[model samples]
Target: MYAAVVRSYQESPKFEAIDLPEPSGAHDAVVDVLAAGLHPRVRSQADGSHYASRGELPLVPGIDGVGRLPDGRTVYFAAPDTAFGSMAERTVIDVRLSVPLPEGADPVQIAAAMNPAMSSWVALRRRIAFRPGQSVLVLGATGNSGQMAVRIAKLLGAGRVIGAGRDPERLRALRAIGADETVSLAGDPETAARRVGEAAAEVDVVLDYLWGKPAELAMVPLLKRRSDRSRALTWIQIGSVAGPEAAVPSAALRSANFRLLGSGQGSVTTAGYMAELPALVDAIADGRLSVNAVPVPLADVADVWGTPAGAGQRIVFVPTRGAGA
Candidate 1:
């Protein structure tokens, strides 16, 4: 079975085919690959720069995928924290880690949407105490997680959803995906903040994906303008796409009454996921949540991973040609 194996952690590691990996334990079931989700974190893992790097070579780098077991169970999983990932024709995963897909669902779409959707779901529903009718400002709104955040915020009854990104066209697309307003970060931080302030002053919640000076700067004034001190503005920091180090003034917190929180898959317990997965899956199956997935063959995985696409659109790698549903 062909798999994308990284021989070394160089600036540009070679992704090529290698021998199929065997299942290690009885609890680990081998999945017949169907589709895999490509994220920026996968590239970072390949380059030995990801936060969870084990410094191991010849790693299979993919974080999420949809596949089938020997008994013909269709499943999708958020890849475990290991070098043995989902970027292979056959890969092993613990049975508990895999979620069985609903019957007649699109495999590529499910694979693409799972990671981003889960990130948004976990961040909004679990990490932050998101209340209905609260206004939400989603930073980096054009990206995968940001777009999911926008949709999830709206579905969960956010009063107003504002999406902020660098691109105008992408911002327009965000509006179609449940964003009531879109703000471009092309201008200075003050300018961006003022623009957002004009639209909706004192946002109740902020879901921040891009960290760094710009994100920090843009959020500072917005946080300062919160209507009530004890009303509680929440900022959930999920990713650092812009840059890791952010310069934020401590003085801004006086009036904001904000709760800055970090959210990710690792933060949640296995038992928590068992309870949450059912509701999330039900939402997907019922069409309450939607994902924009671009289906590509597994052979084109490298090309798709090479460039950054729109934030809202997900790239799903389908292993079996002419396979759908």
Candidate 2:
């Protein structure tokens, strides 16, 4: 079988012929790869930068993808952190982690949207007790997952959604996709913080993707502007795109009724993620949650590995079929 093999953390994944691993676990089965997304998570996995990376080399880099099982069912499956990922003609998958796609669901679209969409979808559903009509603020709202967070918050019944990002054009574009208001995080820090405070001071929830200095700085101003400091504010750390560590203000935590927590692999259990998958899959399949995606041949993985996808467009790799057929 052929796969995008990563031999070093410093180099791009090359499409090369490799032997497929036989299933060893009770739930494991080799499935035909249909579409795999080139997500930031996948990039980090390939480069050995993700916290989950075990520094293992000579591996295939893909977290999750759409695949066809031996039983002929098309399902979306999440791959374990093994040498053989879902980037090949065939890869091992835990059958229990997969869910069958609804009739007429587009595999490419599902591949492109699921991972990014899952970040916010799972966070809102499993991380917090979110209710309809509550206001939301999405930090780093210009990125792929952040953009989806804006829409998901609205779909989940957020009364008002505020989007803040460093891209002025992208921030402006957020209003069309259910953001009640948008703030530009570009330019002078003081000015940007003030705008964020004014726009999202009273929001009930914040889905923060930028956690470094940007998130650290935004907190104080946002907390100060709140009309009622005693009101509950839930801040869910979804991604650390800006930076990992933040010198959080001790005063900020003590000043208001602020509750901070993370939402990801360890934070949300496997059962928790599985429980939310069905509803989320149905939403993406039915077009309730939409994403812009483009399909590229898996053979071109190495060439496009370092290239960034166009604004708001995710790249989904389509491997040549029949190898696993």
Candidate 3:
């Protein structure tokens, strides 16, 4: 079968013919991959940078995809056990990692949205002990996960949802999706941080995606402006697309009544994720959650592989269907 073979961490994957692996465990099953998303996790996996890193090279480079069984039942699958991943004509999937999609659900959209969407969904519903009507600030809100955070916070009964990001136009547009206010992170660090701090002062929870300089900027001013001291503020770190290290203020931790924690893989257990998946999928099917996606053919992936999927539209690779067909 043809797959996107990644031989080295420094290189892009090549679409080539490769030997497919047979299932080793009774729970494993092969599925015809219909569509797969080029999520950040997939890229990290390919380069052996993700937390759940699979360094065994000469491997297929996808973490999750929409696939169909021999009986034609469509399912959204994750984490191929063979270490070859989901970017292929066929891949091995553990049955426990697969979820049945809703009728009329767009496979490409589900493929595109699920991973990013899952971060905030699980964080809001499970990672933190959430209370309805609390205020929220979604740091780096222009990203895919950040956008989802704003909407999901509202769906879960947030009173005010503030979105802060580097893009002005995109941040402003977040209002349509339930962001009560938006702050621009485009200026100098101090200025942007001040704006982020101003917006964040009253929020009860923060779903942070960017954690580098931006986080540092926000933290400094946040310490000065914080007002809610009735309860501990929950700051859940979800993504580090901005940068991995933040020169956080010592006073911010010393003075503020807040708890900082990460929300993905290691922090949230497999059982916690599984418990939230059904509700998250239900929200998508019921139209409470929606993903804007464009389908690209697997053959054309070489051209668009490392291209960024901005908040506007995520790209989904259709293995069987031609690009945009």
Candidate 4:
């Protein structure tokens, strides 16, 4: 079988011939990899940069993908924490961790949207007690997952959704997709913070993807502008695209009713993720959640390894051409 093999942490995965995958677990089955997304998480895993990476080499670099079982059933499967990932012609999938897709489902779309959409979906559903009609502010809303966050917040019943990001064009585009308002995090820090504060001062929840200086800078201004500082504010940290560490001010906590927490692998249980997959898949399949997916042949993994997906675009690797169509 041919797979994108990553032999070094410093280099991109190379398309090469590899041994066929075999089922190792009792519930595992070897499935034909149809479509796999080249998500940021996959890049981190390939380079051994993700927190979960054990520095394993000579591995494939896909986290999740759409695959076909032996019985010709299509399913969305999350790759195990092993070297055998979904970026291959075939990979082992544990049936327990896989969700059978409905017939006629678009595999490329599911493969593209699932991982990124799951970030915001699980954060809103499992991470917090989010209520309908609550206001939400998505920091770093220009990126793929962040853009989905804006849409997901609205689908889940956010009365008002404000998207904040550095890209003015993307920020402007966000409003058409459900963002009630948009704020640019460009130019000077003070000016950006003031804009964020003005737009999102009374939001009930903040889906913060940018957690470095941007998050720190926006904190005080947002809190200060709130009509009632004591109002409950839940800040769910989904991604750290800006940076991992933020010098959260002592006053940011002491001054307002602010709650800070993270939502991801360790925070969300395996069962939690599995439970949400069916609904999320259905949403994407039924067009409740829309995504822009560019299908590229898996053989081109090395050539486009570091290229960023276009604005609001997700690149999906098609290992089996037309198999997932």
Best by TM-score: 2
Cα shift from native, residue 189, model 4 (Å): 1.7
lDDT of 2 by residue, 168-283 (tens): 88888999999998889998877888889888999999999999978888899999999999999999998999899988899889999999999998899988888888898899
Tens-digit per-residue lDDT, 219-260, candidate 4: 999999999999999999888988999888899899999999
Cα lDDT computed for each candidate against the true fold: 0.75, 0.91, 0.82, 0.91
lDDT of 1 at 261: 74
Each candidate's TM vs. the true structure? 0.90, 0.98, 0.94, 0.97
Descending-TM-score candidate ranking: 2, 4, 3, 1
lDDT by residue (1-325, candidate 3, tens digit) is 7778888888888777788888888988889998898887888888889877756878788878889987788988776545788888888888788888888987887888788889888888888878898999999899877888888999999999999988878888899999999998886888998988777787888899999888877876875776655457778888898898887677777777877888888787777777777677778877888778889878777778777765578788877532222
Determine which window of 10 residues in candidate 2 has minimal summed lDDT.
316-325
What does candidate 1's lDDT look like per residue over 1-325, in tens digits? 6667777777443345566666777778878888887767777888898777889877888877878899999987767667788877778888887778888977777776666777778777777677888898888887777888888889888989999888777788887878888888877767876676555456788788898876677656675555665777777888898898786678666656767777765687776665577677667766777677787776665566667666567776667532222
Q: Over all chains combined, what TM-score does candidate 4 have?
A: 0.97
Q: Rate residue 156 of model 1 by lDDT.
A: 86
